[model samples]
Target: MDKLKGKGKEAVGKLTGDRRKESEGKADQVKGRAKDAVDEAGDRAKGVKDSLRSDDDR
Candidate 1:
């Protein structure tokens, strides 16, 4: 998953002394953040769908 990969990159940055690795970690962190946002949006949409379905039942 994106989250796991992000953590791995961060760990590698700490383990190695490469500046590129550090930068890569930072980039991966950003990617992970975006992925989280997308997931939240998906959850919100699902909640709306469920609410609409319940209303239809009523």
Candidate 2:
């Protein structure tokens, strides 16, 4: 979602030389950064879950 928004903003900025478009791109980039952090945390959670499941199997 954030990535899509960021790409759209970036493309629009490139197409148009509007200051608002550039600002939008900056905002989207920040959103993307937050999304990346969330994804990393989710991945860590999944890894812990998998490790626990494997231990149970053993």
Index of the highest-TM-score prediction: 1
Write the residue-wise lDDT of candidate 1 on 1-58 in tens digits: 6667767777888888766777777788788899899999999998888888865576
Residue by residue across 1-58, what tens digits does model 2's lDDT show? 7767877887888788766886787788898899899999999998888888865586
Off by over 4 Å in 2: 1-17
Residue 33 accuracy (lDDT) in model 1 = 90
lDDT of 1 at 56: 56
lDDT of each: 0.80, 0.82
Candidate 1 clashes: the total is 0
